[model samples]
Target: MSNYDELHRFLLNAANVRGELVRLEESLQPIVHSVEYPVQIQRLLSEMAAATTLLTAILKFKGEIGLQIQSKGPVNYAVINATHDYTMRGVARWDESLSVLPESFQELLDSAVLVITITPQEGERYQGVVALDKPTLAECLEEYFTQSEQLATKVTLMTDMSEPTRARAAGMLLQVLPSQAANTDVKNDTQFDHVCKLTETLTEEEMFSLPVNDILYRLYHQEEVEVYPSHPVSFACSCSKQRSADALRNVDKEELLQIIEEDGAIKMNCQYCHSEYVFDSVDVEAIHNGQFIETRKDQ
Candidate 1:
């Protein structure tokens, strides 16, 4: 069966290495088309969504993971947020005045910094930042793992934006298990490098079209892989009329009433999913009165 919108995890029992493969199809469409982003921005946002899924699978705790890139360049901000179950949503913003956008990652995000934030459901949140000095998103992620976790990691992020209406993205992650790496030997290190070399042979066609198992076999045909149950991934935005109302609670009631009086209603929009929520006088009054007033969600 096809592994579209699913994540598969595997471990090389003999080499003490772990791997994850994720492919996004239907889950990527809503995100890519959430706004009228340029081709470059679409590709970049897709890549980030794939990477966030791969990273979320590597975590042992149940929480949310956010991968963000910020810079003083053409693209000022981009972020992909994912939950432990692989539910994902993302958005990107770029300068519209520029006639041409850079085709390379470094050029598009000059002086950029990649930030990885993990917020556990029960524990304190953790965040790590690294300079986006590499030419590609994959390499910069590898640098992050090396610096923050002290482990050698390899990441491959690919996107198929050929069909404007049907975009796809996929990613693969390889890393050494910390528990099994207490006593690293030269032989084991060599084996890890060997496996990484094989992984480098993956092409865009195979990565985007082939099944997860098939791709793994093609790359690690000689290694003993212990595959785990696959997890389903989908596009889920954490936005709703109630959440929008909660945000409006912070604003002064008089100010909100003034806006409602002028416009007949207050409107809120979510950038991640292009969702619109409108609150009329009654809804606003109920909100201020600490009463529940259910309103329909606008798309």
Candidate 2:
């Protein structure tokens, strides 16, 4: 299987429709292996990772986008973040005691809500919430696009969690572009439906193993697609010791002292990367005095 991670953009010359294809391997391995999650949860996280990557690629600004699931069932919380540069990280929380995995999204996440957040570098942050009424994450996301953007969108997500050591995810997005003429609405809808039907024939094996061009050709050989250069995707955490120290400044001094007294140092762990940062007594004092403080990684 190809382990390279990349995102590709394509345009349907015949129709006013655009598409994106994302394949994640190296970028998803670290995030999925950060914790010992159940196989089902791992699959969900992997799908979210691919979905976030696809969504971020369509952004017009420099910022971050996140997909968060808040539920009251076995799976409590799940989140995936992707930056404009394609750096990705994700985590999930679930009930460890549950022995049987839920068979459906509704069973796994009762009373769940999916939240999509977009933070632009220069404008106000935007968010949209959608009920998890669909059977799959991709369908739920399609609902989000229809309700929020008023654009017809189709999303397909596939994740291979069959092996504990090897993780792979891929997703494709197809959406109808905004039209200027009322007469073209019917024509655009017909084009979108025809292309979507072809996309629906894609399989998990092809999505995981096939190259972008091959996949596109196989699905849309009859149609003309204008393929563009691919963008590399990677797993990168935006966490650093300096950022950790800055976060410590917001903590109460007394609480910091108590933590130091109990453990001999204050430890802050980055949930995204699983990197630990430790601050000793002197370091805490520097933070209190409004001076720069340095921290050492926990070996």
Candidate 3:
């Protein structure tokens, strides 16, 4: 079984490939606390949440990476946002049925698409979209990386919410070093193909519950591996009243005042944390008077 309560990192010393494993049952529980979501929806979010943490750890840049799914089915949408530090938060919208768990994401989500977005701390954002034409989120994400980033990235996400209110979600990612030159001849393709075949043999159970060492050894025992120190992940939300105020500062005075008058106070909700920020008439006037000067510059 995988190690509990920690993230594990491993690498192939001979190859330009690396992998990571994490157990996030406790880390993700708080995210689903405020709502009574269906089991299927909760499981889905757990998988996505786990995967987002994995993606966040892979990034060598500063900023946030978000994963989103939109379907024409009962569960209208789900999204998980994560920063490089493994800070994450998620929320979902469903029209009905907490028992909407289908055997497959395709069946559960009607014609869904997985979208990946990256927002650098100081640069423009970039997004990549992939069709959820697979049976699992892991496959859908793998498709995105194969097509969008052109990198040989394999991802697996899993969760166990059976009892004891336990929720364990973890993932393993394998990708080739993009900087390495690929042999144009058929030989390189043959070796890459071999690795892919080995990785394909991984299972959801093994990934979710197996120890990181066993998981890696099971897949690549024949190859040399270099393991690294890992950073832990949790269900962290980056929301606050100050951030809510920053967003409000962009609204025109008329629009701001109209909202305030209509509701007696301007209410802003943090979609990530579900925290409510109420702005009274005074708060509204201060916003208009350039009290949040930095926000004005943003506008």
Please give, for residues 1-299, the per-residue lDDT of candidate 1 as tens digits. 38999999999978788999988989998888888888898899899999999999877899999999999999999999999988999988889999999988888997899899999999999999989998899999987887777777878999998999888898989888887555344245877788888998999999987778889889888899999999999999989999999888888888999999999889998988878899888787888889956657877
**How well is each residue in 1-299 modelled by candidate 3, as lDDT tens digits?**
32664667777757667677777866778766547777777888888887887788767789999999998977789999988877788989887744445655676788788888999998889998888888889888776776666676767676777753666676767776676424322135555556667877988777776667787789988988788876766677777666777788777878888887888987777776676777777777777676742222111
Q: Poorest 10 consecutive residues of model 2 by lDDT?
A: 179-188
Error of 3 at 120 (Å): 0.5
**Residue runs of model 1 more than 4 Å from their true location after superposition:** 182-188
Model 2, C-alpha of 292: deviation from truth (Å): 1.5
lDDT (Cα, 0-100) at 15 in candidate 3: 68
Score candidate 3 by lDDT.
0.74
Displacement of the residue 276 alpha carbon in candidate 3, Å? 1.7
RMSD of each: 1.9, 2.2, 4.3
lDDT score, candidate 1:
0.88
Per-residue lDDT tens digits for candidate 2, residues 150-237, read 7788899988877788888889998887771232333457888898889999998888778778899999998989998888999998
Whole-model Cα lDDT per candidate? 0.88, 0.86, 0.74
